[model samples]
Target: MRLFRPSRRAASLSVVLAATLLATAACSGDDAAGGSGDDVVEVNFGYIPDFNGTSLLAVAQDQGLWEKHGVEVEATSFTNGPLQIQALGTGDLDFGYIGPGAFWLPASGQAKIVAMNTLGQADRVVAQPGIDSIEDLEGKKVAIPEGTSGDMILTLALQDAGMTKDDVEIVPMEPAAIVAALSSGKVDGAGFWYPALATVKKQVPDLVELAENGDFEDTVAFPTAFVAGNDVVADDEEKVDRVLAALRDAIAYRADHMDETIELTAEFNDLPVADVRADAENVQVLDLEEIDGYTQDGTFDTWLSGMQDYFVQSGQLPEAVEPSEFYTGDLFLGAGE
Candidate 1:
């Protein structure tokens, strides 16, 4: 999922409001740690429901990986990445999961990516079967989570099919909301990430899978990372290292126990085990080296450029901001190296 709102006009206004609030909140003291022991560093983690990062958190917590690393993590779910980054900047959260869209904000110097969590999942776009192809979406109400990676992906797919945003009516809604919207005939189609895609398709057996992330880029690689606030990483480097170590262990565990991971993820998400298994099949957990490359080689750079262009053309950003200012990769890969 994405982090920011889709309406450029709304986001611009929000950025101002968020910055003001952040400046004001900075004067207040930190909230009390969730558990005892000064040695215990509290890491507030943000997640969007049904994303791979949510499963990673469940895995890390269930295995006591954080405890082994001498850290205590408090997981929080967010509606999108921009809000996640906002919370990170304000110190409400220390770290969290964000898709490529959120990565743009940091790649442009708005935030930071501490760890690359999941990659290569073919997040799919499902439409009612009769809709058939992208061209069919024109004039139809397409439901998407506004300002997310999914929305951008959908937009790109439409462009590939010789269509543009102007060709279709875009309805902004959450991933969960898409299922009902589609079923009730409120929308002709929707773009969603895993578990929700599975759930929605199951409910609407006639759903058509119009496109996948891989089809757009052909790399089978899209990044969903563990991002930390700049202040949090700088102020508590040791804690950040410990968190990365725990996450690395969790990824290793997930690689070794597919069935167990799937079942646990399903339990944590309260979804059917089969659906979790299907979602897991699409997800490719990354090792540290691969994650590092994503940041270093400008994979994120290209994606951010696309987003910025989309925002600019759509009038989201007041003016183009340098993408480099938003991303920082210096802190990752050290723990598992």
Candidate 2:
């Protein structure tokens, strides 16, 4: 399922809901991290409720690394990307661990990606019986979230298969609905990232994974990145640095405590520990070198440009945005400080 950018409809809806969020924020007491010291910074962190970079944030919270770094993290969990983007736009969330939508949303002028959180094999396509491969997908109904990573995955998959959107019937579905649709036989297959991908695999034993985001030739990394709201990064850049530092510590903690990290992911996502561990093995927490490569080697720009082209071609995005404008590695550069 796609962790998508906000559609026109969702954007319009956010305008009405944003007022409620503002009131809620106002009534929720001090927005600052719960301390009086100048060194202390309050950070409202957001993440998807799954086994992605959120697990790293869980490690940070569990290890008290955020506090140790002089930042108080008030963590909030959302189920998907668009909601997280909406929260960022409404000033309700300052930081997020998000999927490809992270860049696209920011390209739409909502937030800014500060660091690569986890980048590896995450997005997947599960096909039902008779759909043995991407080639078998022709004429079948395939579900994907438009204007998001899932859409890009499908496009790449089709390219790999020597097919195009016209070769299959594409159905737009949300991440939560994709599994249900597939299980109920409403769609022949679906594309999404985990823990939803893991969820569907657990629930639908017969479904076979046809492809993963890593399977793509050009775009091998399926990244869930750390992003700061535009205002948040502008107002207190140091806090952004602190948050990245805490996450770096958390990633190290995850490396040393794999079993515990898997357990936390399983419990938080309500999945079997085995599934969590299996999925975790496929995801690589981005290190400084790899993260730097994305910025310096023009890999991110190439991928983003390709993604924007697909979005525009598919009619999901009205126009393309340049990747270099919204992506950054500055916070990550200062993370060790």
Candidate 3:
């Protein structure tokens, strides 16, 4: 049995890596299997086994961008951010793609942020038809992956709607289970993200979106990001930058080649092309120039810092870590200058 099963995204790489990579104790930088070529840097990059988390990775894997940048990416999938953070701390994973846990891992000093992957646009309060608003969800069952951005959004939505967690039965389930539950009427609704978010709605077309990433924008921004282990940031600048350069290229490719991005993601992850395309449309990733602006104008910092404070108030984090401690913004395409 695969110890870690697929949660939000497709499992093409996860299935292979679970049996192969997870079998290995660790694949840290110093101990990773050597590339056939000497100049190639080997990186153990971890991501959630889903479309939003794995899109750029899918692009890099399919488009030959990693090899073009002289890096050999060992793509690994985790069920969630903390698992990746555990691997990073133990020198197993060098970097990760993470969502809500992005805030906790960094704030708890378990990981460090390197770059933004998606700007928290994929999650929403999805419900069965006739349930048209957040208040309608009161006294009902709603499924959400615990500690995810979706969870945060729902918490705030409840407050805004004049309800509380107690007002609804919050059913904590895996992404796959959430899909099944919502479709079967086991859950009246879900605070969820793609591609599972897209999957459930497509499976049951009458599902209604009660609130979404944009609705929570006035409260917080749930960004998914590529995060690195502490040691890598402290010493391995070249390796860090090389990986970033390759990812940056993948981002550039994803912006204009969205069709290719959707197709490649579906192909690599064994997901339905239509649903994958829909999920792709549902989320948003920043381009290089936008990333630069976020970094320079302090919007990016504000986005995360405010969100972190809410995380503290929401009792997810005991306290906040200085942005400098959690975010190494100077590493990517010349940010933090």
* Best model number under TM-score: 3
Residue-wise lDDT of candidate 3 within 173-210, one digit each (tens)?
87778889987888899888767766676678988988
In candidate 1, position 311 carries an lDDT of: 57
Please give each candidate's TM-score. Answer: 0.77, 0.77, 0.81
Each model's lDDT = 0.71, 0.73, 0.78
Worst 10 residues of 3 by lDDT: 27-36
Cα lDDT of model 1 by residue, 60-170, tens digit: 878877766667877887877888888988989888778765555665565677666776465666688688898898899888887667776776688789888889888
Q: On residues 252-336, what C-alpha lDDT tens digit does candidate 2 reach at each position?
A: 7777787898888777666788877777776776555665677678876776677667556656567888775667665666664
In terms of lDDT, model 1 sits at 0.71
RMSD (Å) of each candidate, 1 decimal: 17.7, 16.6, 14.8
Choose the strongest candidate by lDDT: 3
Worst 10 residues of 1 by lDDT: 27-36
Compared with the true structure, model 1 gives a TM-score of 0.77
